[model samples]
Target: MSSGMAGANTEQPAGTRRNRTSEAGPAARRASRATDTNTEERVAVWDAVAAYVQEHLLVQKGVWIPTFGSFDTISKDIRTADGTVTLRWPVFQLARNLRAMHHLGSDKDSLPAHREVETLKYSEVAAAASVTWQRGKTCIQSTVSLLSNCLKNGENVAFVLKDIGVLLFEGMSFGIKYYYDFLEKLSGKEKFRKVVFKAPWLLDTLVSRVAPVASLTHSGHLVVFPM
Candidate 1:
């Protein structure tokens, strides 16, 4: 991605900080942000931004950046009956959350629970807690814009999301092919010791929610009573 925003490591004044266009105003903030930048700064910003998104994603249902859109997962229920189906896709919806954030005029609907994920315990700093959020988010928007530039420049482009996938833009089409398989990403894991004693996994019903009526027979019949 191209150079985004400003220096990611630029130390701010030692005092209270907040997420806003500016303490002074949008015009002043815009003026304060220098136009000149380089690839290194953008990459730093992106790395920080990607880390922030990954953190929020693990704890919350989804996360939204004002201009970048939404980062969330698409889950599919997996049950014994629904045998073959699997694989939960980590989805990146372009500009959907931006419109929503604008109409609502709040971060309530857009962002994940900020205070819930702690920097001390989880080593996660919420968007409001650190400058990283805004800086990273700006870089995210810049990253998207970089992909958009391809269509204008007429070139095939791929944006690498570390540990996630490569976002491809070719022939005026866009899609993400993930290198990591978030298979059954949200599905509950079985506590083998506690659950297996009750019933073997094959016979367990409703994702360990309900008792199985019978064991599966060799002939594929239900045997309520073993003998």
Candidate 2:
């Protein structure tokens, strides 16, 4: 039996063995390359989405999706039944049209009595907001042009945007500084030390709000937003 096995092994050609190895090597290499490409594509997509969310949603305070919904953050500090304090994060709620399309019930009951979620269609809201942003951009552009023209003509131009608290074309810039200083005084460490530290209840009131049921998670960290 051993001699028979030896004869069979000897009969197997080296060229055939090399051919099999060469065939498997290329196929395995192709499969590995394909897997790597897919993984990279997925990672790229995830990163893009994360960046968009960070910039528009988190930084800008809110973002509206074309077909899905809007996302916004709401800070809420609350005490649990056992007296443990927790901060509730922001969450995304389904749009009215989306909810209706999915046959989901209205979220009116879940919302706070004092606040109302806009029920406008996504397209309408997006269009309106886009127009507003465009108008703001146009105003800024015109202001810049006016400033340039004034400077070129050797004239002093003082531009002020009351909403943003900005004074431009002046020797002193106070708009952003004043705004930031006000915000800092309102919510910064000094404010916390003087106000919240002395009156914890006021801090609780400032951060506390009626949260919706959808804003909770099993691990206690609320997911407030739907993917």
Q: Judged by TM-score, which candidate is best?
A: 1
Q: Output the lDDT of residue 53, model 1.
A: 63
Lowest summed lDDT window (length 10), candidate 2 = 218-227
Q: Residue-wise lDDT of candidate 1 within 131-196, one digit each (tens)?
A: 354454444455454433333444433344444444433443444443322212233243222232
lDDT of each: 0.36, 0.29
* Candidate 2 global CA lDDT score: 0.29
Worst 10 residues of 1 by lDDT: 218-227
**In model 1, where do residues sit more than 4 Å from their true spots?**
1-35, 77-88, 96-141, 181-227
lDDT of 2 by residue, 1-227 (tens): 00011112222221111112222223233333333223223223323332343344334255544334444444434444444332323344444553443344342113233443333232332233343333433332332333333333332222211111112121211011112222233234454343334434433222111222111112211111000
